[model samples]
Target: CVNCGKLKADLNDTSFADKVKHARDPKTRMSVVWNYCKTKTICETDAIEETDPDMPDEAAPVKKGHGGCGHVQPQIRKEGLKLFLQYKKT
Candidate 1:
């Protein structure tokens, strides 16, 4: 719930779509799509690292496979990185 607010407020100042594609599955090795707001979004972590968002200061570890607290898919991760690199090239 709190995380939802952060996304809506753009507190992280990052694109949600980009973050989701970077998420990885704990067991599936990136084969899960976390549905945020009825949208199949990539998962992210509580800690807003260089690859993560600027979430709450004291966020908890996102549960794996839940699809809410930052459980992203493998394909998304690959796609995200590709797009990121492409953008950087330009």
Candidate 2:
């Protein structure tokens, strides 16, 4: 699995030891099944469901008045940022 090696090395480089650890553990790594399947499969839904799936597909603006992506979500912003930086570095 070339991609697996790349992902591991990339994560290690980015200091995402936790994600790597979880992904490597036998119990939690099964979650990768979702990622692999999601990559190869597509989901189709009705027009109405597609139009609005409870939440917007895009990240809402960080505005206090509008109750946008706020404290409720406790954004994992750093995790994504680290992965992004690793991807760019590679």
Candidate 3:
């Protein structure tokens, strides 16, 4: 990913499900997922558990975050036979 290095979308995530549903082929699907993942800067956060009406005793499984870092993506730059990673501010 461009920012976060982890996959924030899972099967239970609607965002991921939507991408999967519209995929034409496996290769294209992977590309689509990658493109989307690369554009996202923030990672997913854990959601609060909710109890279902049908199963009052058991709360629905809470979604876990991808635990991605909040740092900016660095770019490689070279000048005068020197190489360095340049991090741009948002």
Candidate 4:
């Protein structure tokens, strides 16, 4: 969820809106937005370290990719839908 946190931070910054406005085209703008909003996977070691020490490894929610992060997947799907709509508009 680090990337999602960063995206929220970037979105909270007013400068991000200005940058989006200055983007040359819809695709470029979407690219900039997507860069901030993409899903990132936590490595196994980091996931383990961040998890509760008392929790068993089997019980700990650690998966190799975006599967572990439910929050990001919906954001990504929403973005993809938006991009498709944008493309359709043009």
Q: Quick one: best TM-score, which candidate?
A: 3
Q: Write the residue-wise lDDT of candidate 2 on 27-90 in tens digits.
A: 6655654343333211221122234466675754432221112111111226644732112211
Query: Candidate 3, which ten residues in sequence have the lowest lDDT sum?
Result: 39-48
Q: Which clashing pairs does model 2 show?
A: none
Per-residue lDDT for 67 in model 1?
A: 26
lDDT of 1 at 31: 32
Superposition TM-score, candidate 1 onto the true structure: 0.16
Model 4 — which ten-residue stretch has the worst lDDT? 39-48
Residue pairs clashing, model 3: none
Q: Candidate 3 lDDT, tens digit per residue, 1-90?
A: 346555745556677878888998999899878776665544654554556679756455545655555555556578989988766677
Of 2 and 3, which scores higher on lDDT? 3
The parts of candidate 1 lying over 4 Å away from their true place are 1-36, 49-68, 73-90
Two-way TM-score contest, 2 vs 3, winner:
3
What is the full ranking by TM-score, best candidate first? 3, 4, 2, 1
Per-candidate TM-score against the hidden true structure: 0.16, 0.19, 0.47, 0.31
Local error of candidate 3 at 21, Å? 3.9
Alpha-carbon deviation at 72 in model 3, angstroms: 3.1
RMSD of each: 14.7, 16.4, 5.5, 12.6
Give stretches of model 3 more than 4 Å off.
1-5, 8-12, 22-24, 44-61, 75-86
lDDT per prediction? Answer: 0.38, 0.33, 0.65, 0.48
Considering TM-score, which of the candidate structures 1 and 2 is the better prediction for this target?
2
What's the CA RMSD of model 3 in angstroms?
A: 5.5
- Ranked by TM-score, the better of candidates 1 and 3 is 3
For model 2 the local lDDT of residue 67 reads: 15
